[model samples]
Target: MAPESTNPRGDLTSEVLHALSKSDPISSTEAFPGVPFESIKAALDRLASRSMVTYEQVEREEALLEPEAEIIVSHGSHEARVFEAVRQAIDGLSIQDLENKIGDKTVTKVGQGKAFKEKWIKKDGAKLVALVDSINDVTRDQLKVIQETRTHDAKILADLKKRKLLKMQKVISFRISKGPKFALEMVKEETDLTAEMLASGAWKTATFKPYNFKALGADQHAGALHPLNKVRQEFRQIFFEMGFEEMPTNQFVESGFWNFDALFVPQQHPARDLQDTFYVSDPVKAGRPAPASADDKHDYEAYFQNVREVHENGKYGSIGYRYPWSEDESLRLVLRTHTTSVSAAMLQKLAGQRKDGRVPPARYFSIDRVFRNETLDATHLCEFHQVEGVIADYGLTLGGLMEFMEIFFGAMGVTDLRFKPAYNPYTEPSMEIFSHHKGLNKLIEIGNSGIFRPEMLEVCLSDYQISSMKIETGGRR
Candidate 1:
């Protein structure tokens, strides 16, 4: 016999070893009677950690009463109710009358069928007559017994299950046994080699805990860039390789003037609808762009007049949208819907340079986040990144745009390129770009490209040629 100990760990370890010495195996319930199984499991785990015992879990089926079955056990089965109803009647009631007395349709239907099958009742015309003097409900009695005992008789349990009166659940139980280092008693194991023990010459007799070299250690996580950032980096590198200057797109907040009006997009365009664009409203207003000096104010007024005329009266051998352009609407602030806003600003700066007689050929590119008010799905998001490129020189054409795209995508191992006819408000002769997807075995539309329309270009420059294209990407699909 093992000595009883007050320490729960030592006591549990000793009990398990003692039980295993007598019986080859013992269940957790059998070893720790009247104790919570979880507490016992915890004690067993501590012992197993010390390599003094071990356990194997087995799944067993347990029977439990369904809600309806419990009601039957409490109030008596439907057949029992029918039998009692018949006994209470001096002259047997008719089938319809008995149904009225019972009220429950299931009880009426099943009870009558079962009573007739057992010859406990017989039909006399429309009336039901009791043929037996007394009856017993074996189903109800068995269910009550099962509920009280929490044990099952195979045949009875199967019958109740077929009737949907009992449900079976899979429960886990532990079968524990002695480990390789089984012992009748447990001693506290030291986890460290203390200086006090060494100084007292007690290190030689200390029972140190064993080390488990095979045990897994905590995961070591290091910082890494997000998938979108990695792709953006690759795009940045490609832009650098192509001698394209990076445009500053740090301004996520922009006025509708630069976002749409300067781009020659109509005020009433569907893209400006609340359903498609996210409008900012905390301050509820954005300050107007102030001029640097009186001369700057005069220059901006002239530019503003030209943009307003282009939207209302058309310009440069083209018909404008011929609608009222609202200065208030243009002043409204929003989260930028595209990176092209930055390109628009850069174009304005280029226009000022042209005024100063210093127009220079330039290529600009930007990759930045944008927002929209749209329904989200696996293939769409409310916010995403936009990649844009602009070229300003003496003579850029639609053909030049196509060639530029070919070279740009070719650097990334994408050789197969297709351009489909498309439409945009600010870009004429627009085309949607596609690339062959090997894994998908089809051509997938990748982005959009086109030469900027004259109406959009006239607002930015007067004596220099310019072409711009934008692509929306970095959204989950």
Candidate 2:
């Protein structure tokens, strides 16, 4: 009885280490015959990662016999078999008899033609007789040599491959050698030190894996500001370059008294409706405007009364909306619908007398978030930023305002501006600013600008001061 053969792969890694211990370098194919290439490669890789073994892949083409070539190796070549069967016959074998004897018509037919071409056989009145008494059977001999050696000359290999008797396959083997940390026994590597190792004093003798500092660490995916904020910063820089002070718009929540009434927006305006504005619910009522700090000496009561009177009745040489204005509506807390609200508060602060007994001309700008109760769309949002600017001085006119708008927009590479006459409740002769868009082949409205109406500025500035102010709003679009 034959003994059961053991699987070489069962202890491939240990076998490799043991082999490397005896030899400086060993061929995996010669050391581990009948083992799978993948299994040997996996074992070598495992040892290499631990720095216990190193190896180089050795690749070559090995000739493998096909079924026909294997059969020829076991038996003789097809043509040789045909010649032997014919020579063994007492009289000679007929074609049909030869086919029956060989049990393969294809081999018999092909061999018969080859034998006739080689003059090894001749036709004797429909009987096949051998013309030669002895035959070499070179094909069978060559295939046998290839079966033992797995290769021959390149020309012979090509011929054999063309004959479909053999095929060439890429065989990968490894040349393994002892690495720097070569060992017959694998030791457990410590990736990190623990308290237990320190307590036992085992760290001194423990083998720790070396760190690969060259390896790239995992991505952190750091944070960044939104595109709107980046653009806001750029606009702020431009405002600063133009001598405009940045208003503190951190107060997103504001009373209607500052957001609307001070801006000359009537209480009955469509913009004040629940569908158009976001009204805060908790602590719905807000206190009336008062001094921001002890140093603030602005008359908030007088400014508050002036706003109420302007909206309720005529004020500053113009008839007001003449509708019943509610103090509750004025003091209703809401998410500010515009940064213009901040502009309004700043303007009111300028109303107080300075050391010169007059309000100084000022340039102010704000870029911050605003909330609106509106249907969301690609071009519209419930909350977005507004870029607004205000300039107050004497002798400022519409022409100067247009020129300033050109220079402001030009600084940001916008040109060919066209202003269309429009109207706003707070700004007389309002203009909707548009710039020619070459891509759209038309003008697109980029912002709105106008001078503050006398009715609106009267409550915020002294009567003796005829101030002209231009508001550039919605430029963020």
Each model's number of backbone clashes? 0, 0
Candidate 1: misplaced stretches above 4 Å?
A: 1-221, 291-298, 355-358, 464-477
Cα displacement (angstroms), candidate 1, residue 221, comes to: 4.5
Error of 1 at 80 (Å): 99
User: Could you give me the TM-score of model 2 versus the true structure?
Assistant: 0.56
Q: For residues 1-477, write the lDDT of model 2, one tens digit per residue.
A: 111235655777899888888887896545677676667777888899888888998888889899999998888888888888898886888999999999999889888887888788888998999888989998888898899988988998899899899999876777898999898888878999999999999999998987879768998876787776777788888889999998999998999888899889988889999999988899897999998799998899998888988888978888988988899999999899988888778888877754466678889998888999989988788888788889988788899889999988888888999999998888987899999999989998888889898878878886556565565656347
In candidate 1, position 162 carries an lDDT of 95
lDDT of 1 by residue, 105-172 (tens): 88889988888888888877777778888888888888888787655899889999999999887666
TM accuracy, model 1: 0.54
How well does each candidate superpose onto the true structure, as a TM-score? 0.54, 0.56
For this target, which candidate reaches the highest lDDT against the unseen true structure? 2
